[model samples]
Target: PDIELHPSDKAASFSLVLKGTSDSRTTAYKDPARIYGSSHSEFTARKRLEITANGLRALAAEVKVHETNNEILGADTDVGGLFAGMARNTAMKKARERIPDAEALAARRVRERVASRLNQEVDASVTSINRRLRQGPGAALEQHGLGPASLAAHSTSKELVVEASLLFANQLAAGSPPAALPKGARAVVQIHESAVNNAIDQLGLAGQTIEGAHVRERIAQALAPVFGTSVKLPDDPEQQAPEGSITFAARAPLRVRFVDGQIEVILHAASLQRGNLKTPAQVIRARYQPVLAENRVTLRRQGDVEIRAAEISPEVVSISLQGFAAARDAAIGAALRAPMDRVFRPQINSPKAFTITTELGNVVPLEVTALESRDGWLTLAVR
Candidate 1:
């Protein structure tokens, strides 16, 4: 539904009217249930906005001052000055409400959105979808692309509920209880009562939204792009993925990130070891960070040992070398003259193999499984 706003300087002038449904039938978003329900209310957009509260505060404060000055002017000035005061007050009031508190609120909203995806929402949503995909009469886990060894697995009969459901307040707390009733949830999601509590015990949720433009860019990456604006899930629920192939405009640089997957790589260019570093570092390191988990790699350099740039599976497990030694890319450039200092391992497992290659692949076997993996994204294929 197209909403054509009347440009007027009065509270009475700015009011919303729903075009499609009765007042009783609208969703909490006041959206009518239509198959093609593309039209969303401005109120709905404002709800997700991080700065709505601050804008309201700024408005109330500014308006009180504006109205008060108009009164003082009426007492002291000529009718002309009084009329001018009224006009200024009206114009300011209209502009103030119309123009959102973009800067301060934008910053806060982005933080909230990223937090929702990372700390609160993304995991729940993935669980919901995975549950739905898992459902069926005797549905095989392989049908959903999951093998039997998926650590703890969800049953095929299970269903899940995941949605953004815009709200201005009480966006569910970090790890709150499951939603009491599912709204606008798909039939694919069979979240019923008796099992709801149990499911909540088994599953988890985090809060999230599309907030900062930069945050939006990150959300787009961590979660794949659904449309121009919507986000889909990454391969790993607990990991933040990089923006796939989105070009950034000069005015708006694209930054790929997510709420909880704080995987980033930084590089310093030394004329001694300067390479096409920063961009590649962020790219390659993220490629492996999900593999690195939260652990830092501590290399023991007996004397300038060779390191190979390795590949992580698209699902972030099992590194299949395009045959290892062919990877001559400089993993690090340490001179043997300096008594060979190993790159300090943070959460990195101590990988020692014949030449760090061979089938032992040293770090590859040790770093790939959950027992040795850090943070939340690691798995080992049970033999």
Candidate 2:
């Protein structure tokens, strides 16, 4: 079989030419005498059949994304076959001459059979491909709270090129089409900051609040070793904490922004309370530089998280308590940084995060070769 691809902007067309031959033999016997059977004669017929199918046209179909699965539209193909040749034995010469245009009739029958078989095979292949797609990439996208926003496919002389844009679930499919994949790269994934934020929203991290008692307990646990003693923190606003004890409460929503070749996480706290003192709302910005590793891309924290007081003076406290304020700010920063790192480390640093499995059970590991973040898009180049 020879296959050729013709690609246009909207869809790709394919033509297939198939050639094959088949041979078969048949035997028949006739008894001359009934009761006193005297003799029997046997006749044998052999034939070699050749068929060629040309202009079998197949077109790349449109793909639609659904909630539970995907749909393939216009998956029909046009098949045409011709009976090229047929070799018959001498024993079948008399039978062949008895019918008018016997060869032509045989050719038509063979052509019909070939066309039917080809159509069946094409249908089966399409069904299998559709099922595998739904089970593999479709399921994976849903797992990450993403779906295809738009899809287009075209056939080049060498291959079929497919381009698709992804959107977070429930997000409106409105955006400029993504840029083409980088040359020589097997695959590239371009993620927008809004998509990341949507995933975070799916995780229920936005507007999450930590109770003061829970916050104080975690702080004490973290500072116990540094202070060389177990710390007891009081959460009541009216109660006074011991020298090393602290109480904290925060309600912050996590958001991500892609800018300047880095990812900046903005944790804006709407309410923050420390024991009897209620501090003004603050913005905790953590910048991460994306670094490409052997099999994954990780966001490494650029520096200590920046704590900026929102709508207030730079000083976290009065001048007289400068020393105490410095220590308090350090502890609070440490507390905030730990959990954020924990939440992001597995997602950003693990090689499995860049791996995908096909329905055929083939594992394709995306080895990160380059990473770039700018203009609200984070692009990863994989080999």
Candidate 3:
């Protein structure tokens, strides 16, 4: 099959809402310990933020300051200290309750104090998204994507609200389909073994090994767009079967295995080849490791699949090449690099959106109201 590639100037508009609560405790006065008792105040703030291509904006925020409790844990009839603690606690509580919108007022004061640091955080997040969507494989976002970024926030009696719009260059592409959820449908994905197996089969390696002579033909057919003119698979099995073909003994079996924490497609006795250098097939396993472990594929709970370093066992595995073992090992590792770094591993028969027991409504795309990871599934609420 022949295919043509074209540059896409298409863009997507989605809203990401982040909501959470923060708990804080601090000493009311710096020298409280010297007074034979500790006086401390505790506060809780509930914050909601709306983030868009424009920037991050506060939705609503609510803050509450608990009355100070100035009491010594152990005291030998320290009547003065006891009364002082009681009086201070009573006074603070009364003052806070007596005022209208006290929590909102307090939240405003807190926001003002941390405004500079908060703005910096928002800026940093926007910068990161911009950098990711504008570089290398991510550059498919086209040119000058994110626009006119700005942040706005305010406090209310119930909570503090933040709204941000990160303006980027975008135009509605012609006849673009809306990613709306089907009527009465939900947004939960269950990635089963069959779905994974099918994806692997699409790679044309279901019954073949990387060392096969015809591997390049299969790879070229599957990934012509990626490797392009530089594509090559120089290593061939020692025992040849036919021209541009691999021996039946060199074939490997592939299966998707579901383990305790994640799902993996294991290619038994797979071959790893870089140019003319070949390494053991087991060296090509894809374990979803963390981002810090950049050597391996960065697999997070987000369900996105990435290519990373496979595991290498201590057991002596045979190398096909006669010389340059160390250099060949490195070369083999480089060749097995992930073809697609970040891609949504879609679940078969997945829902468009989902509703959580805690949330009042269904979550959908365009507006991702909520996100939860439960029962090994990443559940998302969309609007």
Candidate 4:
């Protein structure tokens, strides 16, 4: 490839053609990987081709720089001849002669270079998406108070779509989902995971669900002597245990389920662990609704926000939160102890107050209709 650059005040430019031929008997040798059932030979060939291509590019650049210098310094044509002689020295001649087929190698390099460039462009385009905008509908939007924490992008004919299950993790203000983009431009997006996680954290539930069998297993593990080798319990999400008991240690994943004005928790081993048990496995089947409520704290799902005693309002450019005391304490602790986790956190907390905020940068207005829960994320739907 040859390129010409116009002279600037500080420099001059020259066009140079990389001359090479692609016909070579050496490449007739089959890449060993194709025969040996491995890709090693193919990889080796690609590396060699890249190295050769880069060397040629450097050589061409050096020649151009010298040419520019000669023109700038007001040197005559004789100086150009001197540079040509130096570039065509014995080493250059031998390097060219040693190559089996320069043109064939250059051809491979061109294809690889073009493919690399396209891959880079695709990555850049996908990463450009704005978080608050571009939520699409699917099974990912079947639940309330769910919004995508991140997106996995795949290219389409003119836009990119996420065909996989997307996890949502935050609350959104009740309104239309944000629009995707204008036409005739590369479609891409960025997701705000931390912002969503913060909004969802107010609920104290974070949509965590565990089956009864899992709870049983955890209890058995805690009381290994009484439960023996294995433990069994119901696997249904809505099913509860009756007339059973088991003990477990603290810090097990406690799940809270809210139905009407009541709250039920599973995997809570605090009460059972206090007594000695003969039927340890059988005791694990009891499901008790706990009388747990925080003063001035409300847990409810509205659109994409899980209410946990906070005042949140969504605007065209930003979502505002006030008086989320619990979320504030947790975030501050996380920031002070595990500061590394906040390195890429997009949601910003105000030092002056417990108010948190995040903004949508330059996106079209769209309506958000539904939110669904996925593992670690919520999916948002636009209508």
The model with the greatest TM-score is: 2
lDDT of each: 0.24, 0.48, 0.36, 0.28
- TM-score, cand. 1 vs. native: 0.15
Q: What is candidate 1's lDDT per residue for 1-383, written digit by digit as tens?
A: 12223332221111112222111111111111111111111111111111111111111000000110010111111225548566545544543343243223433444344334332332343344445434531143233222222111111222221221111122221222233322332222211121221222121111222222233244334322112123432232333332222222222121122113232221111112122322121111121233323443331112222222333345743356443423324433222112111111123333222122322133322232221222322212110
Worst 10-residue lDDT window, candidate 1: 60-69
Q: Which digits, one per residue and each the tens of the lDDT, describe model 4 over residues 1-383? A: 33333332222222323332222122222221111111011111111011111111111122111110000111112224557455334333444453445434444554465345434543343333221122322122323333333433322223334322223333332222234443333222222333332332332332233232343444333322211223332233433332223233233323333333223223322332111322111101112222212221222222211212112234522434434544663443332222111111212121111222322233443333333332222333332
| The candidate that achieves the highest lDDT relative to the unseen native structure | 2
Q: Could you tell me every candidate's TM-score relative to the true structure? A: 0.15, 0.47, 0.27, 0.18
Evaluate residue 40 in candidate 3 and report its C-alpha lDDT on the 0 to 100 scale: 39
The digit string of per-residue lDDT tens for model 3 on 194-245 reads 3233333434454454434454355445433221223333332433422222
Better of 3 and 4 by TM-score: 3
Question: Candidate 1: lDDT of 331?
Answer: 35
Q: Write the per-residue lDDT of candidate 2 for residues 1-383, one digit (tens) a residue.
A: 45555655555445554555422222322121111111111211111111111111333322111111111111111222442112122223334342344334434444555556655655455556566555655554555455555666656666545545545546533254255556666556676776555544544334545554354355344334322345654233434332221122232255678889898877666655545544445576778888866555566778666765544465745788767766766666555554433323322353524677743456877666767888887777766
Ranking by lDDT: 2, 3, 4, 1
Off by over 4 Å in 2: 1-6, 11-180, 198-206, 210-252, 272-280, 311-348, 352-357, 360-366
Q: Which has the higher lDDT value, candidate number 2 or candidate number 3?
A: 2
